[model samples]
Target chain A: MIARNDRLSGFRARLTGAGLVVLVSASALLSTPGSLEGAQAAQEAPDGMALYEAGCASCHGSDGRGAAADRIAFDDPLPDLTDCSFASREPDADWIIVSKAGGPVRGFSDVMPAFAEAFDDDQLQAIMDHIRTFCTDRAWPRGELNLPRPLFTEKAYPEDEWVWTASANAEGPGAIVNELLYEKRFGSRNQVEIALPFGFAEDSSTPASSDGGPASDWGVGLGDIEIGYKRALLHNLRTIFSFGTEVKLPTGDSERGIGSAEFQIEPFLALGQILPGDAFVHLQAGGGLLARGHRESHGTAEHDEDVREAFFHAVLGRTFTSGEFGRSWSPMVEVLASTHLADGAQPQWDLVPQMQVTLNTRQHVMLNVGVRVPLTDADVRSTQFLVYFLWDWFDGGLFDGW
Target chain B: MAGRWGRGPFLPCALGVVAVGIVAAGAAESGAVTGRIVVAEGQVRFAGEPPAGAEIDMSADAYCRDRHDETLMDRPVRVGADGGLADVLVRIVNAPAASASSPAPEAEALLDQEDCLYTPRAVAVRAGQPLVIRNSDATLHNVRVVPDSNPGFNLGQPIQGIQSTRSFETPEIGIQVRCDIHGWMTASIHVLEHEFFDVTGEDGAFTLPTLPPGDYEIEAWHPTLGTVSERVSVAAGETPSLTLEFSSG
Candidate 1:
């Protein structure tokens, strides 16, 4: 009889626990609807201007010049959106991706926090629009016009840049050539460029009595110093055309087989056309005229008189992106043709298959590598491997954006 | 057992209950306003000789020349017999506050390249709405958009029946689009953040419906004649008709 009484007490305790649970659940259910309604009412679409002021103005500033250095929390300085030279070149899609996914999406710093939950795609786009207003000047060609650089064909767009190019023979005599080119834009459509070329090649050190001797030594010296001027005749959204003239000076030691020992002048026209699907074409045609009665060096000249040559080069390529605002890769094929102006001179042809890739987030630094294969006269003209590193100084400093 | 349940599963259940309440409260409440836009008469004026039949030089492309039956002229202005402007855009500049509660409408705008020319010389689209660009010509063409307040894009369409879809994120007054292959091919687009916009037809009339009752700033824009704006007040259950005039100096 005592055990039966203990069981009755246990049943009573269980009933009380069930009642407490029912009470708690009912209270929560009763209060939830009101709070949910209030939250929903607050979730209205945000005004673009107001959102910009609240979210971005703290760092970017009201005028988009960036906050004063003292007031910022981070060590890295902010970008100046008002500078059209830098801001106008980046496409909207890139800005949106950076803002929404944060800087790391384009290999930038982790300090830029992701706002994936704070703003929707449309909201981010609206922010981009507001940022675009900082750049009021429209005379500078937009960044979309800056197409990929081809391996052999020069682009028509005037640029402020520095490029280092290296070429090595794939076959035949051991040789290595390098050139440093600096281009500066003076006005809206005019640019001046200077090129310094140097190389090391196997030298034939035979005595003067010998007519054709085998190379027995290696010599390193300067090749040629070239200065050029280019002017853009026409530039539109789809096409850019330019004309240029260059003068090459004899600089290296002719006896070392490192220079041509001839003063030459070249005039050329270049054209760039934007095609569908991020594809493009570059065309360049020029003629080189050597000064009359120039002495041939190292018995390298095929003719005794001054020689003139005409050349044509064409490049076809397309750009592909890693992501919306990420790295870009361009694969191009260049066709090169050259022939001497002298009678009975045969035309020579070469093909270069290359790829150019953007290395930095700002897309100002790039690298291109290619192989130049001689299609005609392979025995005389050796195949070469070419590589170049280009930097667009107008975008940002070397260490920036990484 | 009670303490464990309260520390884990119970917390989530409570939050879910709150979320349910928030969604119920967020139901949309919207009211609409209706109006008709009309253009005033005798407003078409030009500084130079009226371009009645100025022919375009299509001699560069034989394919373009063969597609046209007669010589095509540059017609910047198209007016009906009633002096009604066909392509004038009418939109609400300052939308009412109720727009915050109304969801953006979904629609697509189309621009077509036919016979080496852009059809529908001008169009208006809502921001974030899809814009379809079509190439119907046999020759290659590229679409280049230049906008001051928005991101620009240059797209190439090499094949016929090629179509591309894009959307503008910001509201711009007018964006110019051109074909690089044929410099003469051009089109204009206006992007708005709100749906309260329309283009006038042959009758020079436009209607903006489903707008909430409030004061609004209305703007009528023309590609060449410029823009005109006026303030208007609307009341519930009432339809308002208004006329706008444009002049060339």
Candidate 2:
């Protein structure tokens, strides 16, 4: 660059390179920004780059790239502002608030000091605008548009995460169901995922035998492994749409009664929408084509062909952060509907009410707990308790940010 | 690159056709017609010794690195061996105010992203004039423009050879343009209210469009260096030549 005189003559340059280093890592941009700062960001933006050099550059570096680990006081990994895929999407308010109130306001490392003493709202806003310039690419969807994940409804945003989910019957026979899901993002709008299901169940028909060393009535085994691919079809500031397909392999033993030994292919479409007041809606609709399975009754085996099922899931929720920028808690309710593709087949409905909370400072790891209560055929279907541990591996290692 | 002419979307193959339609419709850009009313011609030169070249680290992107055999340098301040300053904005700031017949450049200003760099890193255009930003690289790139006066837009161009056309309604100087995917790729779009400006090329030479003879205020702007201004008096008999100098050290 030309040896520009330090006369404070440029707008974006003075405000951006002027020195207010927000050090707002890619994390602030990776997640949705509906918290206190984003919600209250003033529309008018004044110059703010001046404060970053004094308040944040010590650790964030003068260029918005994180300072060297050895140079900073803390050992935490700093956010790279140059990463466009993760840093471009957050609104100016999220970073402004983080800069003013410190990292803790948004569940970030406390090492990031607050700059409220140095600059006002417009100044902070100017710095945020400058900070955003670090990430030039606008193709990646902004993290602020990525709404909270639902228990059953698939979200539209592509992600790099791992989720372990477990469920048990709240009533009747004791059954434990578990699933491990891994999702990987490849390009700007494509993602691939795989899910492994396993479970254990107790047979109420047989009584426990005191003479036996192990209970013969209980069954435990792996179920079906599902592989799927999804591509984001469209996305704006508030809406996202995706189309995907999944194939399930019959890998479990049907006689154990713990797995479905039938191969199936499923196709689905998912959508996520951000509403006012931190509210969100997620919808997933799909169909399943199942292959014939063998069933034994009275020592005779029967096989049926051409089985198909259709399903629809909708989740409605709102996110609330603890005091402006603390841990985020999202309360959501899901409505699920399914039906067999057969004559006179009746549709089954269920309601899943759940809450999702950020568990660490980085806010990459999260937990969601809820119960799926069968709305139809209550006598046969049992209410199940559901819980999941979600890790956004793309953000950091499982134990890195905590 | 499918949107190779500038409406956006790194969309699926199906959407490629829609992008092509948009490009075809907006393909015709009306270029300005210049008249033979030249007032002055000059060269922009460095006032001091040229600075050493700073290499740009293209290792982050293999495609960019593979495209070049040698290293890339960030040449924000380009000074030729003869002392000519490249990429400087030179214009008559007071021509339009004086009611001189100044017209915009007949050709639309085009910014292309090739070899993971913005071709012609610095360009000058008039207000209401169309600026076309194109992606010539095979890899992914998103062009982000956050002008202080105009509405900001961040557009994705995943496909190769795609281009987008946009214009700034208001006049603003030092408008920053960048590629988010490649942080090193940057450009500046200088939008002036009047069409009496031009960016100096390798020789750092710029000639103002025909202007009526009068005392006109002239200004020179460098992206890295600060802005400089000079007063010039034009006579009907002669086309005056002057040197615009930028500070160094």
* C-alpha RMSD of each candidate structure in angstroms: 32.3, 25.3
TM-score of each model, paired residue for residue? 0.49, 0.51
DockQ of 1: 0.01
Q: Which ten contiguous residues of candidate 2 chain A have the minimum total lDDT?
A: A2-11
Task: Score residue A172 of candidate 2 by CA lDDT.
Answer: 67
For model 2, give the interface RMSD: 14.7
Superposed by TM-score, candidate 1 places the C-alpha of residue B165 at a distance from the truth, in angstroms, of: 31
Rate residue A337 of model 1 by lDDT.
Answer: 68
Model 2: runs farther than 4 Å from truth? Answer: A1-78, A88-94, A104-111, A204-216, A293-303, B1-249
Cα lDDT of model 2 by residue, B68-124, tens digit: 767666656554433345666777777657433345545778988888877777888
Candidate lDDT (C-alpha), each: 0.63, 0.63
